[model samples]
Target: MPDASRITPPVVAPTEAPVNPVSMHIRLDPGMPLAHLESVYHAVNTEKNAQGIYQLTLQDAQVPANRDFELLWVPAPGNAPQAALFNEQWQGDEYALLMLMPPAPAPAGATARRVPREVIYVIDTSGSMHGDSIIQARAALKLALERLTTADRFNVIQFNHQTSALFSRAVAATADNLQRALSYVDRLVADGGTEMLPALQLALGQQPEQGVLRQIIFLTDGSVGNEQALFSLIHQQLGDSRLFTVGIGSAPNSFFMTRAAQFGRGTFTYIGKVAEVGEKMAALFSKLETPRLTDIEIHWPQDQPVEMWPARIPDLYLGEPVLVALKLQQPNLPLTLTGDAAGVPWQQQVTLRGGAARSGVHQLWARRKIADLMDQRAQGVAEPEVRKAVLDVALTHRLVSRYTSLVAVDKTPSRPADQGLENKALPTNLPQGWSATKVFGSLPQTATASEWNLLVGLLLLACGVLFSRWPGVGFGVRVGPVSDGKAHGGNVL
Candidate 1:
């Protein structure tokens, strides 16, 4: 019988490399209000033209002439900001990329409800707030108060190294009462270290009663050092009261303020110029009147493997409702959804199949928001397992997360010396644990000292023999074996 080893086939190990998942990061300019939705879509589909304006074409984004997405817009405070939601289900993993379209400009004649709102202006009077920061903050508060309707209720809370409430709780928005509150705001002088945690705690402690649209507008210009602490404090106290944040100064710690507002379920506005305060206040108050749409929710049933970015965050913005796009495993069913608006919910559904996913650019935006949410509070999770799960998903998906960035998962080794050169072609003739760049397509320097000496000796011996055996006619002149002697002086020497 033939030997078993000779008869059996060799097991060839697979050499295929693993594929990396692709993710796209698109930035949405918060400057655009609502009128720019079409422009946003154009920007999404076509390349910007010479003037930086988006050129719209039917072929762009593969949108048909009659194609239109169900538009839901919600107005909010700051810059006439509107939420946009686009619902569609497209097939294929290729379409699972994130797309952040630019926000549109504000539209005309947009209105909100005229409900009673109680707003508390929390001004940071820390010593650091001294100067233009305090001045601008006071002006911004005054401007915001001017925009408030008579039916609204208001109060002022000033905090620095400590917390100070104008009154124990909220007060009615009366002309004389508002004037008295403005007087207190004008007297605010910044002169203490930012112990923002205590101030925030105090503000959150006074929970506004029900049926009142309670909000706290926090203005700051410096780092409090206890940002995470403040976020936790706010999250703990979060219950009906929304915390809007206004970042003052040219270079404030925006990350802290932004996250603070986000955690408090409020809006964030940045003041680039002093003059912007009134406009921002007006825009914010305008949102108070109109019910953009209530009961805002994203409905993607768990029938298939569906992932929505920003799964827990609020809706997307157009000019009315936030723009939301969903990715679906089965698009033929036409995914339908609704957003609750000030107790009024709007329903929308769309069917997607086959090539429809390619046109469903909104789905990419959804994934991106989800990525943002994942990275938002990685440190806050109680369990390392949960944090690791989020981090792993973020790493695998390449989401722009704070906790898990692209470089977070280090495939590279910590110590270069410890890593052996991973050469696929080099044979393992090297000593164990030895790691060096293996020379390829070249012979190794294997000649020992003795061998080298022997080679040189052999070469010298050949040269000496050739020189001695040469036939010479005269000293320093030689005649070859077949030379016809011509009496040439310069003959072979």
Candidate 2:
């Protein structure tokens, strides 16, 4: 055959490697128009697997400047004109899902009054947060202190190997106290191992002052490995106090920060760069000063079997809405949500009806269930049972979890039997406004291990080609030489 493969030679190397892929799952009202989005995201690989469920894969995804999803409603079957609930048929299923949005905040100059806050700032001074992390944290704490009014009482708690409080107890937000706090924060330095349990114990164990909104704002790089223990401590001691975690570093453990806040019945915030400290802290302060919706309870119809995630709802802050997901055996039931805003009773009710069948709703419910199970596991639930439950949910939904990961393998092996695979770590960028030299004591190299591997592969491939062309060289021809099967070349060994 005169070596047909040799007659039409393939290119051995690509000019550039492909970018990393980003995946997104979205659910909307079934049959909604998608032409506009298709045009905008032309390069994305998008497909609708089921009604109202879409999967999108894009290379090197970037955030859109304007992105929003507004829920669509349709008239319910046999629904009264005056009925408060509206429904759309679930696109592909028999079950109907109900949604209710809380009433909007009262207009400015309304009767609602701001609550007095008792604030405790918990800061981490671990060795990993030696430089830019500590600097930005101090700046953020100072800004928080400045936002305190005379009506507020405040304390500062910093932790490393041990914990210390700036005052014996939370003191009035007086001029003298504020200045002393500022000086105290300035003199703080980062050192020692992270021992967060003691800090959290001190912050939450204090007897809460009656009628005051108690909040603990925790700032840290979230580098500790013993997350389960900390979560247990927070749940045990978190009587009437809320713990809000502020992620502080170029890379923080997002899973820990988010789940900790969820368990603490509070919200989480992130300040990735020094410049964002002011903006984020200001927003947090606004939420702190506003009247919150508390003691939230959702009343489902007594007759039907209903399952809902997030058994306990967190208090709602200003401009925040309440969302819950549930699966019901029967339809056409009424759901009532009740809460208190500034001691004024507030309630909203919505009747259930078949809505456009959305694809990802089931998966969303599954994720929440898995998260709840994890929280239970952290709080002394049986390990084997919880692990099995989490694994089942994760595998069913094809979602990644601590125990399960998403992995792909090719059917065909491209490398020689003698070849060895190399692994490398990827390098992440420093946060904006942070100096590399200051953070690391010197400017560190930015090249990732993958880049080095690619370079070495190219060099070896070049050498192979040169050796193959030699007069006396004779080797069995393989179409591709790259371990990943993405490169085309003949192996010479």
Relative to the true structure, candidate 1 reaches a TM of 0.58
Per-residue lDDT over 197-242 for candidate 1, one digit per residue giving the tens place of the 0 to 100 score? 7777777887766787787888886446555567767777878888
Off by over 4 Å in 1: 1-47, 50-112, 313-328, 331-333, 340-345, 352-380, 399-493
Task: Give TM per candidate.
Answer: 0.58, 0.68
- Candidate 2 residues 1-493, lDDT tens each? 1222221122111233323323454433434323223413224555666554565554335432111112222322221111132233332322333343334445677755767889999999876577678988999999999989899999999998889999999999999999999999999898766778888889998956789989999999876667788899988888888889998865666778888998888887776667778877887877767636678787976777767777887777643444566666556667777777667787766666634444566667668888899889777899999999999988877888879997888889788889999864443334333334333332124222356678899998998899789997655645666776444566443
